[model samples]
Target: MNLKRTFGAILTILGIVGVIWGAYAFLAGGDSVGGVSMNQFSSVVPFIVGLIFFFTGISLIKGTKDTA
Candidate 1:
């Protein structure tokens, strides 16, 4: 596999992990590391990260190969 494909895979994994972690933080109500609620704006970080990862993965996967 090419470097782009490898990066795409890694990004995909990171996206999935981020989504899961975000969902957990959203569902499992409790105090965060800083004694704050996980459902706060900071909690959205995971979702955003996940989205970034997902989009990057898609872009990489869509890239073309010019070898002939």
Candidate 2:
């Protein structure tokens, strides 16, 4: 497999996991830090980041497949 595809696959898997975990955290209520609930902002951040990673990885994998 091409390097791009390999990396993309890894990113895709990680992104999926991140998205699931983030959603769970957001719904279940994440841990608190200094009296502030992490679900307030932290969970959202991961979900957004996971989306980015997922899309980027898909693009990379598709682009590589087309070229190869």
Candidate 3:
């Protein structure tokens, strides 16, 4: 079992999910809390983090590949 590849796969999936959810939230608008909306923060942060996670995951997976 390749731990690096497995972990990378997991991260990649999570990143994809995060990016989708974040985009949805950003477009759909977020609910107000105490009359203060966190729409921008919630959406932007997740989208950025998701991108980071995705790139990191890809790097890990590629890094673990056996080269002939």
Candidate 4:
């Protein structure tokens, strides 16, 4: 198995999951837990990180060579 390709796929999946979770959280409006406001940090951080991970994984996968 190709390590790079496998890892890239994993990363891509994780990123997609993260992005979805972030969007859900944002839409759900659950930023506050105990009188403390996250100021959208809870959602924005994951969304941004997700985007980064997604693009990085995509690039890595595209850059890697697939050899049988």
TM-scores across all candidates? 0.74, 0.78, 0.78, 0.80
- Top of the candidates by TM-score: 4
Superior by lDDT: candidate 1 or candidate 2 = 2
Q: Write the per-residue lDDT of candidate 4 for residues 46-66, one digit (tens) a residue.
A: 788888889888988999998
| Winner on lDDT (1 vs 4) | 4
Q: Give RMSD to native, each candidate.
A: 3.3, 3.8, 4.2, 3.4
**Clash-forming residue pairs, model 4:** none
| CA-lDDT, candidates in order | 0.76, 0.79, 0.79, 0.79
Residue-pair clashes per prediction, in order, are 0, 0, 0, 0
lDDT of 3: 0.79
Among residues 3 or more apart in sequence or in different chains, the pairs in candidate 2 whose N, CA or C atoms overlap within 3 Å are none
Please report how far candidate 4 places residue 60 from its true position, in Å: 1.1
TM-score of 4: 0.80
**Per-residue lDDT over 1-68 for candidate 3, one digit per residue giving the tens place of the 0 to 100 score:** 78888899999988897787677767767765345465866778878888888888999999997554
Model 1 per-residue lDDT tens digits across residues 7-30: 898898899888777767766665
